[model samples]
Target: MTGKIVVITGAGGGLGRALSRRLASDGDTVVMLGRTLSKLEEVATGIGERAVPIACEITSPDSVRAAFAQIAETFGQIDALINNAGLFQPSTLLEASDELITDAVMTNLAGTAFCARAAIPLLKRGGHIINVTSESVAIPLPFLTIYQASKAGVENFTQMLNLELYDRGIRVSTVRAGTMVGEGMSAKIEPETMMRMFADAGKRGIDMMARGASSYESTVDAFRLILNSPADLYVPSVAFHGLPAGWTDAG
Candidate 1:
């Protein structure tokens, strides 16, 4: 595991960037894939020779195929595929535009599947596929219906894929992540819409806007642990959440 070649989608920012850095620091070669070449390059430059930046629009199959091909040619084989690229557009169902809905499904569900399929042939036996999902799929945050639904589909897909790939010596697993903040974290909602969503979440006693979130850097350890698991041990899924800073059970 020390010198493994790992490919991560959305590696330009947020958790992907953090994971890429952490993995490389741990002695693995990291392929950073994202829609923006500049962004990916920025990260790769920081990681030096261990990092490979590739421009990839995960929502497009052709783009994904080409990026993976580049990865295959450069590295010859990959030890892991981290489906970490996603788009989170918050909007009420009534206010949601066609593009928002389409992007969410395409990027979160379709893109993940496409990457997994493309990586299948290149994956060595004992290779792992890690799919990142959201805690909101079960927590029911306001104005995230489409996002939640799409990720729910991914969770189910991960389960079925685990079974399907068992015979091939591949392992599929879900990392049901909680709220996380990092340098790449961003929100593009209009102020009015954001206010409405906050109000609605407050009405339900969730008050998500004020909730504490884990840092993206803090979550990288999970991926490291999963990738280094013993050969006989198979982790089907890992679910984690953030608590208020300094929070304790005694409180």
Candidate 2:
């Protein structure tokens, strides 16, 4: 993957920042895209030259377009795109305020698609788009209806584009990741939402830590497997929690 150009959204912190470092270590030119330029710059500083910060608000199509255009002028071309920017506000549909609802829809659904659309023109043959989804859609945890809906939309988009983008020599896939807790990430839930969520999980005997928290390292490996797979092989969507060292057979 040396010299390859990879664009990652929400690269200011959390999973995005960790993933940005992975790409940098692998010798890929990582463009760190996020709403806050200062935060992106902070992360980029640690990564040095390989990671360049780019400000982008994925929810707005204009922001996405201009950002990609700037990337093109600066980098010449993009090899892959990782649409990892999202908002995960846990609340019942009834309890969700207008702002919360809008944030979820815009960031999770519209934002994901908007970035994809903005990148398509710049992407050439063999380009890839990897969308980061969650396991909550399959687990269906309580008080997360809105969050699940947005992720579900991304999953649907990934699946649909997998076939649609094939003719253009592009590949699309989704990582239905399980609960990931790490530096800059909080495992804590809101008081009201936590009570409701726990009550429902108890009834269903749902233990999220059942698989143990997925580490940033394992997730990076999972992504590497997908991104670097043989061009002859067919890579489908995958889900992962924690994978033992040298466990590359996970598909």
Candidate 3:
């Protein structure tokens, strides 16, 4: 209420946790939203009073509405909403189960839409929405058809949402991020699946072992920048990629 109030989804996860900490340190009141209360609280505890943990199952419309209602009551308005919650699993399209496809689409794509719809009423003029997408949508990777498709949908949603919100003075933007590593970051794919994905990527000229990854901490500042940009500056989207291992500047 006193400072900028920001809501970050998936705040229990690595990148989300990092962003929560970084934004709180910048004096914003960060609401950490995720499905797991314990995880959100763990991250919030480290940030002290500036951080608030709220359990939210983004894939559920009722859950999302309830969470935002709570947020509206507590803070009245939010300066920014960071759509960072997502699910990622490696499995061939043909082999992927129905649950996997449903979870992937609902969590990554529909969840984002649900949160945005709920947040619209609470976001005033000059409010910002930062939707996190992945570089995997553009870069080829095996066993990620669902993940890639969902994130691609997010990218498109960001663009169209920006147009819809333009008249309202609420800025919508997308952050297309590359591979990142951070504390508590883990992918729940079987070892064999991972091996197959790696081997397949290698055959396609992409080396997982040699690929570079950014620290989750390194990307948090970019969101801060987006939130603090001048009112006249409208950035529709921004992308970030890590340098490959042993890559050097020649010039």
Candidate 1 per-residue lDDT, tens place, 1-251, comes to: 34999999989989999999999998999999999999999989999889999999998999999999999898788999999999988888898899999999999999999999999999999999999999988887899999999999999999999999999899998999998887887547788878888888888898765577889999998888899997788988888887786676545
Over the stretch 190-210, how does candidate 2's per-residue lDDT look in tens digits?
787777777877788875434
Clashes of each: 0, 0, 0
TM-score per candidate: 0.95, 0.92, 0.95
Q: Which regions of candidate 3 deviate over 4 angstroms?
A: 245-251
For 15-117, candidate 3 gives per-residue lDDT tens digits of 9989998888888999999999998898898899999999999999999999999999998899899999989887889999999999999999999999999
Please identify model 2 stretches exceeding 4 Å from their true place. Answer: 186-188, 208-211, 242-251
lDDT of 2 at 51: 93
What local lDDT does model 3 show for residue 34?
A: 95
- Judged by lDDT relative to the true structure, which candidate is superior, 2 or 3? 3
lDDT of each: 0.91, 0.84, 0.91
RMSD per candidate (Å) reads 1.8, 3.7, 1.7
Error of 3 at 178 (Å): 0.9
